[model samples]
Each structure stands twice: as C-alpha cells, then as structure tokens.
Target: MIVRPRPNWFRMLLVVRGSVLPAILPQLLITLAFALLVTLLHGRVFVWKVSLTFVPFSLIGLTLAIFLGFRNNTSYARYWEARVLWGEVLNDTRSLARQALTLVDGPAPSRIFVHQLIAFVHALRHQLRGTDPAADLDTWLSDEARQRLQGARYKPSAILLMAGEWLRERRRQGELAAPLVQAMEVHMGHLSDALGGCERIAGTPIPFTYAVIIHRTVYLYCLLLPFGLVDSIGSMTPLIVTFIAYTFFALEALSSEIEEPFGTEPNDLPLDAMCEGIQATLLELLGERDLPAAPKPVNYVLS
Candidate 1:
C-alpha cells in the first residue's frame, strides 16, 4: 500500500510510483494508435464507411461510467472490510497477549502463550497470501511445535488450538482463575472470527460474469470511440479518445488490484508490515525492548 505523504498537485500529475498508469499503459497506447488510424481513414475500413454519431457514444459512456463506479465501490467495500478484519486480529491478539502476561501466574507459560500468539499472527498472514509459513513459524515456535504444525493443514487454527490448550493447562495447574480463562477465551474467539472473515473474503470474489461484462464493455467502448468522434472532432480524435480511455482503463486497473486486498500489489493492504507491527507491539507488552525495526515503505509502497 502507498504510505507517503500526499504530493502537490503538479507533482501528483507526474507521480507514477503508486498510480495505475503503468498497468494500463499498453491499453492506452493501443487506443491511441487505433484512434489515429480511424481519424486518418475518416472512420472507414476499405470502402465501407463506419458512420457513428456522438449521441449513442454519449449515452453509452454515461451508463458505462455508472456501472464502473458501482463496481469500483463494491471493490473498495471489500478492501475496507478486509482491513477492518485485520484490525480486529491485531486488537484481539494484543488483548490475548496482555491476558497471558498479567493473569497467568508463571513467566514460562506466559512467554510461551505470547510466542504462540505471534506465531498465529504470522501464520495467518502467510495463509492469506499463500506463502510458506516455515520461516516465520521457525522464528516463534520451538522445533517440536513446528514439527506438530507440519501435519496441520491450517497453521493459524492449529496455533490457536495450541494457545487454547496452553490456557487450559494453566487453569488445570491452578495458575489462572476460571474467570480469567473465560475472559481470555473471549479474545480467542474474536481471533477465530477475524480469521474466518479474512478467509471468506479471500475465497469468494465478485462474480465472474459481472467482471467479464464490465471489462468487455469498457474495452469495446474505448476502441470504438474514435469512430464516433472522428467525423465531428476531425484531427483531435486521438487526443480526446486517449484521455477518455485513460480514465476508464486506470479505474478498471485500480479496482482489479484492490479487489483482492490480500495481494502484494502496491494498492493492496500491507499485510507484511501489519504482521510485523503486531509482533513488535505484542513483544513490547512483554518487556522486550530489542524489537524488530518497523517496516519502511520502499519507493512509497509498503507490502
């Protein structure tokens, strides 16, 4: 995700680091070339003159813009929901770590529980992004615990189960009160809810047919725009068509990138930084001052 301060308007116009321009550049060039050809040929293919009025283009453009706006809004809603779910995970994990340290009697069990929570955070991040959790798990888990996780299909859920067992053991040893156990369980349940929400968003996407229809319409409209404007706009058809195409193409590209908020794209959520932040903050709660440095955005983008 982009993390830099907003640039001035003049610089904003030329900024490319976080914009969709790079993604849609090829489409823009194709549209420009096609528009120039149409203008030169006077909207003709061989002997057949392709006559089209701006009226149909105008009506279609308005409707298309509305549909695009709706789709983009839907995509942004998904993006925002994913962010909220991650926020819940962060908050719940912090609460769980606090409970483990303050409510539990022994330092050994408390540290183990905190480490398990950190492992769960890292595992959840890897699960969402479809990356291997081995390195992250190794950092937080003992060799035996990591071996146990090797057979578990869902590493995050497995870590959560480990955490629950840890709490149960503490309770059995008379180290934690029944009420405190229940309180920590509530936070654990919230963590489970957050995990489930993230999975749901990652598994289900906007319907394929809806995306296909909008994608086809946007491209068709952009490609055929020159024919409608060439007769009236004369030599300015390419410039005008290119500008219009840029808007549609950029919006479509941006929506696609953010729709899957777990992705590593510049516009997607910064899951890497988020997971690290959760780890550092939790460790800080346990009196550890030698924490990992916070992630910095590379070229104005955090991932």
Candidate 2:
C-alpha cells in the first residue's frame, strides 16, 4: 500500500503512482473521441439525429453516482476489515510469545513455540495471497513439520496445531503449569480467530451482481453523456464529457483494485512489511542479535 504523508494540493494534482487513472486512461481517451465525434456531427450520424436532452441524463447521473458511492463504501469496508485482521494477528502472536517466554520454564519449548508462531504468520500471509509458503516455513520448521505442512490443505492451521501439541507436551512433562497452559490456549484461540477472519475476507468477495450492474451503468452513462451534452455544450463536449467520465471510471477501477486487498496491488494491504514487523518483534523477544532491519516504503509503496 502507498504510505506517504498527505501531499500538498499542487503536488496532489500531479501524483500518479497510486492513482487509478493509469488503468482508466484508455476509457477516458475513448470517451473524448466519441464526444468529439458527436460534437462535430451535431449529434447526427447519417440520417439519424440521436441528440438527447439533459433531463434523463441528469436523473440517471444522480442515481448512478449514489450507486457508485455505495459500492465504493462496501469495498472500502472489506479493505479495512482485512487490515484489522492482520493487526490482530500481530497482537495475538506477540501475546503468545510473551506468555511462553515468561510462563514456560524450558527454553527449547518456548523457542519452538515462537518459531511456530512466526511460521503461522508467514503461512497465513502467503496463503491469502496464493503464494507458496514452503521457503519461509522451511526457515523455521523442522523437516518433518515442513513435509507435513506441504501436504496439508491449510498450512497455517497445521502450524497452529503443531503449536498446540507442543504446549500439550510441555504441560505433560510438568514444565508448564495448568493455569499458564489455559492462558496460552486463550492466545492460541485468538490466533485461530485471526486466521479464520482473514480466510473469510480472502475467500468471499462483494457480490458479482452489484459489480456487473455498476459497471454497465457507468459505461452506458458515460457513452450517452456526449449525445446529451453535444447539442448544448457545443465544442466543449469532449472536454466536459472526458472530465466527468474520469471521475466515474476512476472510482470503478479503484473499487475493483481494493476489493481484493490481499493481492499485490499498490492499494492492497502491505502484508510484506507487516510480516517483517512481526518477525522482528518476535525475534527481539527471544533476545536474538541478528534481527532483520525494519522494512521501509519504496517510492511511497509499502509492499
């Protein structure tokens, strides 16, 4: 995601990296051409005068803008929810690590649990984005655990299961007290909830019907706008139509980009930076000296 400070008004006008304008440029150009043609012909082609008045366009435009606003709101809600889930992941993982380090006596089991927690975070991130987690998992998990996760349908859940079993083993050996075990279990439950929330957001999307209806309405409205304006706006039809079309088309494209926030789009959540932050924090809790440097935004993008 783009994480720069807010730009001044003059700079904002020229900002382009994270905007949806690039994706909708072709549509803008086409709208301009169509509006120009309609203006030149006085909304007449061959023997037909397809000229229209502003009344219908005005009514349709108002309704279409409302629908677009609702759609954008729904998409933004999903984006914000996904971000909140990741934040929960970070908090729960840190809590788990702190509990294990303070309550558990055996350093080996505590270290193992922290490693598995890190693996869980990495696995969840890669799984949501549909990328292979083998490389990251191998760094922390054993050959047996790694091989086991390779065949599991959901690697994050599998890793969490390993963590649970590890805690159970320590409890059986009288290393972990019963009360601490229950406490750690609570944190583990939080981890499971975070995982489930992320899966829900990644798997289910805003309904396709809403997307289709908004898409067709925006295009139809933009295309017919020139016919309505050419008669009254005269030579300025292209300029006027193109400007309005940009607003509608850009909103449509922006909603589509952010609807699936797990993907690697510029507007998507910064999962890489987030995962790195989690890793650094957990390793620091373990008193590791070779901690990784913090992640920084590149060209205003934090991916």
Candidate 3:
C-alpha cells in the first residue's frame, strides 16, 4: 500500500509507484498504435471503408462507464472490508493481551499467552497471504507448539486453540477467575469471527465471467473508438482514442489489483506492516521496550 504524503498536482500527474499505469501500459500502447493505424488508413480494411458514427460509441461509453464504476465500487468494498477485519483482529488481540497480563495470576502463564497471541496475529497474516508461517511461528512459539502446527492446515486457528488451552489450563489451576476467563473467551471469539471473515473474502471473488465481460468490452471499445472518431476528428483520432482508452484501462487495472486485497501489490493492504504493528502493540503491553522495528515504506510502497 502507498504510505506517503500526497504530492503536488503537477507531481501527481507524473507519479507512477502506486498508480495502475504500469499494469495497463501495454494496453494503452496497443490502443494508441491501433488508433494511429485507423486514422492513417481512413478507417479502411483494404478496399472496404469501415464507417462508424460516434453515436453508438457515445451511448456505449456511457453504459460502459457506469459498469466500470459499479465494479470499482464492489472491489473497493471488498478492500475496505478486509481492512476492517484486520482492524478487528488488532483490537481483539490487544484486548486479549491486556486480559492475560492483568487478570492472569502468574507471569509465566501470562507471558505464554501473550506470545501465543502474537504468534496468532503473524500466523493469520501469513495464512491470508499464502506465505509460510514457520519463521514467524518460531519467533514466538515454543518447540512443542511449533511441532503441533507443522502440518496444521490453518496455523492461525491452531495458535488460537493453543491460546484457548492455555486459558483453560490457567483456569483449572485456579490462576484465572471463571468470569475473567469468560471475558477473555469473548475476545477470542471475536478473533475467530475476524479470521472467518478474512477467509471468506479471500476464498470468494468477483465472478470471473463478470470480470471477463467488462475486460473484453473495455478493450473492444477502445480499439473500435478510432474507427468511430477518425472520420469526424480526422488527425486527432489517435490522441483522443488513446486518452479515452487510458481511463478505462487504468480503472480496470486498479479494480483487479484491489479485488484481492490480501495480495503483495502496492495497492493491496499492508498485511506485513499491520501484523508487525499488532505484535509491537501487544509486546508493549507486556512491558517490552525493545520491540521489532516497524516496517517502513520502500519507495513509497508498503507491503
């Protein structure tokens, strides 16, 4: 994700790091070249003159823009929902950490609970991004705990189960009150809800056929635009078509990037930074001053 101050308008026009320009550059170039060719040939295919008026394009463009706007809104909703789920995870984990520290009796058990909570956060992040959790798990989990998670399909759930058992054991030992344990359990359930929400978003996506139709329509419209404009606009057809194509192409590219918000793309949620922030905040609650360094944006992009 982009994590920089907004640039001036002039600079914004040339900004590339977090924009969709790179993804749609090839399509834009193709549109530009095709428009130029059509203009030069006077919208002709050999001896056949391809005559088209701007009327159909005007109507189609209006409808196409509406569809694109709808799709973009749907994609942004997914992106925003994913971010909200992560925010819930952060808040719930912090609450759990506080409960373990203040309510639990022993330092040793509380430390174990806090470490497991940290592990759970990193595990969920890795799970969402489809990355290995071995390194992150090893950092906060015991050898026995790591072994238990070795072949576990869902590492975050495994860590949550471990945390639950930790709480149960503490309760059995008369270390934690029944009421406080129930309170912590509520936070744990919130964590589970967040995990499930993230999973649903990651597993289900906008229908491929829907995306395909919009993608095909955008490209076809851009390619056919020159034929419609060449007769009327004459020499300006290439510039006009290419400018219009850029908008459609860029929007499609951006929507595709954000639809899967858990990805490592520049526009995707900064899961790494988010997980680290959760770890830091929880560790700080445990009286640790020296924490892991926060992730910094590289070249104005965070991942």
- TM-score (C-alpha, index-matched) for candidate 2: 0.97
Please provide, for model 2 over 1-303, each residue's C-alpha lDDT reduced to its tens digit, 9 standing for 90 to 100: 988999899999998988988899999999899888889889987889995998998999999999999889889999999989899899999999998998888677799889999999999999999999988998999888987876798999999999999999989999999988998899899889989988998999989998999999999999999889888878999999999999999989989999999999899999999998999999999989798788888988999
The per-model lDDT (C-alpha) reads 0.93, 0.91, 0.93
Off by over 4 Å in 1: none
lDDT for position 105 in model 3: 83
* lDDT tens digits by residue: candidate 1, 1-303: 999999899999999888999899999999999999999999999999999989999999999999989999999999999999999998999998888888888777799889999999999999999999999899999888998998788999999998999989999999999999999999999999999999999999999899999899999999999999999989999999999999999888888888999999999999999999999999999899998799999999899
- In the range 1-303, model 3's lDDT, one tens digit per residue, is 998999999999998887889888888898899999999999999999998999999999999999999999999999999999999999999999988988888677898899999899898888888899899888999999998998899989989999999999999999999999999999999999999999999999999999999999998999999999999989999999989999999888889999999999999999989988998998899899999789999999998
Runs in model 2 with CA error above 4 Å?
none
Sliding window of 10 residues with minimal summed lDDT for model 2: 144-153
Error of 2 at 283 (Å): 0.2
lDDT score, candidate 3, position 102: 87
Backbone atom clashes (below 3 Å) for every candidate: 0, 0, 0
